[model samples]
Target: MRGVVMHAPGDVRTEELEMPVILEPTDAIIRVTATCICGSDLWPYRGAEAIRAGGQRMGHEYIGVVESVGGEVARIRPGDHVVGSFVASDNTCEICAAGYQSRCVHQVMMGSVGTQAQYARIPLADGTLVVTPGELPADLIPSLLAASDVLGTGWFAAVAAEAGPGKTVAVVGDGAVGLLGVLAAKQLGAERVIAMSRHADRQALARRFGATDIVTERGEEGAARIKELTGGLGAHSTIEAVGTQESMEQAIRATRAGGHVGFVGVSHDVALDGAEVFFSSVHLHGGPAPVRRFLPELVDLIFQRRIDPGAVFDLTLSIEDAAEGYRAMDERRATKVLLTTD
Candidate 1:
């Protein structure tokens, strides 16, 4: 089977490798139908993070058909089309049972497990996979796959930020996760949603997703703009999707006192101003998006046509063109890239 291999910094290749087989009692093998590049995949690709392992696959977001299952797997069967959460979690565990599957004690990181391939070996099948309702319309697959990661991340961010009716919400990024945050905020009943974005194309979609305002400035200026749009009180809830220090600070500073800041961006060595944050009385919370917790609900939304997140995918390429997809994202020529395998 062919898979993506990250050999080193600024180096990724589409190459042939042995297909993964069922290795554990709780495992299931999935024939990946669609997969895509994620922002998190950029960390190591740009040399921002060290790659301790030379040979490893990239990507975690995917939707596929179940090809086989281990003896312990009883919830799903062969030929089932499904969308899976990035975290390989047993949803019945204590943490998962409490709606924190991203922090599941025995969770497996999909980056290392690698979904950017012809097939994927999934652990905790019953807990991680959500079967699609019957046969899905062909065009809906991309949106369902987005729910597995970016959409889920955005939804989690909105939930953390306390979005609801009569509240003003602000989204601090315009990528796939941030764009979906706009959708999530609207669905959660936020009266006014502000999206900080400069790209005309993304801004247009943000508006379509229910963003009430668009702030073109970044950093301090952006914070002031948000407050100005909110009548000087700032937003009641803010979602941070970019993990950079500037992005995080901008998000914190844009929220009103006693507001909640939902930060879903993968954090770096960021040190927040303790005094400023304390004075704002902002409640900050976010992590690897407990995707497993929302998988079923999000899947149901897809089956029922409640949301369409596939718009974020501006470019689609064959699995073999993974390099061009990465290059397109790196060059800012594409918002998000999708990969398909036969």
Candidate 2:
């Protein structure tokens, strides 16, 4: 089998590797059909985070056909077209019962779980894999695959910030995560959506995803613009999709007093002043994003054609060309990159 491995920073490679097989009772082996590079994966790609030396499989978002299943993995079986959530959770834990499967007691992150491989061994099959409606329609695969991560993450961000009817919602950042946040907010019923974006393509997509306004400003200017748009009080809700100090401050400042701030970007040296954030009366929440929790709903919406978040993907590549895909995204030449294995 072949898989993607990032031996070190800026050294991602496609190489032959051992195939994954069921190693636990709740496990299943999937013949991957599609996979994608995520913004989160960029942290290690850019040396912001340590890349595990050796053959560390890269990628997390994916959907596939079940190739084999353990005896205990009765919920799914071979030949089933499915979308695998990034978090492997039992779906019966206390946190899962409360609709937070990303925090499930026995959760396994699929980033290390490695969907970039030709074959992936998915633990907790019953909890992680969502069978698509019958055999997957060819056109539906991309949308279904997005539900595994980005779509789910965006939905969680919207839900966390309590986006709804007549609420003024602002999204911080213009990456795939942030653009999708605009889509999720609109679907959640936000009356007006504002996206902070300097990129023309991303801002254009943001509008296509339901963002009503695009702010090109940064830092205090951006925050003030959001407030100005909201008549000087700021938006009622803000989604922080960039985990940097500037993005965090932009989210906090754009949100009005007592407003909610949902941040999903992986934090990087962010130090929020309790006193300052407190005085602003902002409620902070977000982490790895309980992606599994939103899986069912997001999948259903996709199947029904209520949303097409997959449109965020502007570049496609064979798994072998994934390194170029990543480079394209890092250099802002692509909004999001999709990799195909089959």
Candidate 3:
């Protein structure tokens, strides 16, 4: 099988690799139908995160057909079309029962397994994989794939931010996740959605996704703009989809007192001021999104064609061109890139 490997920062290649098999009783193997590059992948690609001694496998988001299942797997069976969370969890743990599957006791980080390939192994199959209602049309595949991670993460951000009817929500990033966060906020009944973005294209898409306003300014200015838009009280809720010192601070500062801030961006070197947060009076709740908790609902939404989260993937490439997909994202030429295994 061929898979994507990162030899070093800025060096991604498609290489022939050994096929994965069901190594655990709960494991399942799938023939990857589609996978995509993630913003988090750029951390290692840009040298912000250190790579291991050996080449690192890339990608976590995937949707595929089950090739085989281990003896313990029950709900998921071979030949099932499935989508799974980026973090594989037993789904039966106490933490998972509490709806935090991302931190499941027996969690497996799928990034280490690399779904950007022809085939891959999925741990905790019965708990991690969600089978679609039936065979899906080709057009719905991209949206279903998005549900595996970005859509679920964005939805989680919106939920954590407490977005609901009559709430004024502000999103602090314009990436795919951020853009989808806008969609999630609107879907969750936010009366007004403000998208902070400098890019015209992203702003247009944000509007299409239900962003009632756009703020091009970033950092303090962005926060000030958000406050100004809300008559100096700030937004009722804020979603921080970019994990940065500036973005995080902006999100906190842009939210009103007693509001909520749901941060889902992979934190890099972010540091917070104790005094500021202490005074902000905002509820902060977010981490690796428990995508598994929302997979079933999101998959149903995709199956019903209620949301087109796949619009974020402006670029698509064959798996062999995975390097170019990475480059396009790094260069800001594409909002998101989808890599096809076929």
Candidate 4:
């Protein structure tokens, strides 16, 4: 089988690799139908996250038909069309029971090494894969795929930010996750959602996702815009989807005292001051999103055609062109890139 491998910074190649098979009682093998490049994947592609000398596999978001399942995997069966979580978890753990499946004791990150391939071995099959109701149209495939990561991550950010009726929610960052954060906030009943975006294209989509306003600013300027929108107190809730020091600080500063800040960006080179955060009086919570916790609802929403998060995917490529997909996203030429097994 062919899969994507990273040789070094900015070097991604689709090459022949061994196919995966079930190696654990809870495992399942999936024939990947659709996969994509994630913003987090850029960490390694850009050298922010080290890539070892020999090539390492890439990709973590995938939706596919189950080709096989281990004896202990009862919930998911062969031939089922499933969306696998980026983080695998045994749904039975205490943390999983509390809805934080991302922190499950048995959690294993898919694609940290690679899922951008013909097939993948998914550990904790029962807990990580959500089988869709039935076969879907080709057009809906991309939307369903987004539920595996960005959509789910944005939803978690909204929930963590406490977005709801009468709340003013502000989304920091204009990436796919931030765009979806706008959608999630609106769906969660936020009366006013502010999207802090400098890109015109992203700003337009943010509005389509129910953003009441767009702030074309950054850093302190961006924080001031949010405050101005909120009558000098800042937003009641803020979703930080870019895991950068500037984005983190912007999220914290854009929320009113006693408000909540849900951050879902893959934090890199970020350090928060304890005293500053404590004085800000903003509630902060985020990490690898517990996508499994919201999978059922998100899947239902996609199946019903109530939301189309797939619009974020502005570029598509054959699996063999995975490197181009990564370059498109890394250079910001594409908001999100989708790869199909063709």
Please tell me which predicted candidate would have the highest lDDT against the true structure. 3
Q: Estimate the TM-score of every prediction.
A: 0.98, 0.98, 0.99, 0.99
Question: How many backbone clashes are present in model 2?
Answer: 0
The root-mean-square deviation over C-alpha atoms between each candidate and the true structure, in angstroms, is: 0.9, 0.9, 0.6, 0.9
Candidate 2: which stretches are off by over 4 Å?
A: none
* Residue 285 CA displacement from its true place in model 3, Å: 0.8
lDDT of candidate model 2 versus the reference:
0.88
After aligning candidate 1 to the native by TM-score, how far in Å is the CA of 77 from where it should be?
1.0
Worst 10 residues of 2 by lDDT: 51-60
lDDT of 2 by residue, 48-159 (tens): 9988756578888889999999989888989998887788888888998998888889999898878897899888899888887887777877788888888888878888
- For model 3, how does the per-residue alpha-carbon lDDT over 221-291 read when each residue is reduced to its tens digit? 99999999999999999999999999999999999999999999988889899999999999999999999
Please write out the lDDT profile of model 4 over residues 1-342, one tens digit for every residue. 989999999999999999887789999999999999999889988889988669889889999999999999989999999996799999898999999998999999896636899899999999999999998678889999999999999999999999999999999989999999999999999999999998999999999989998888999999998998899999999999999999999999999999999999989999998998999999999998999999999989998899999999999999999988988998899999999987
Backbone collisions counted per model: 0, 0, 0, 2
Pairs with backbone N, CA or C atoms under 3 Å apart (clashes), candidate 4? 57-113, 58-114
The residue pairs that clash in candidate 2, if any, are: none
CA-lDDT, candidates in order:
0.91, 0.88, 0.94, 0.93
Candidates 2 and 3 compared: the better one by TM-score is: 3
Q: Stretches of candidate 4 above 4 Å error? A: none
Candidate 3 global CA lDDT score: 0.94
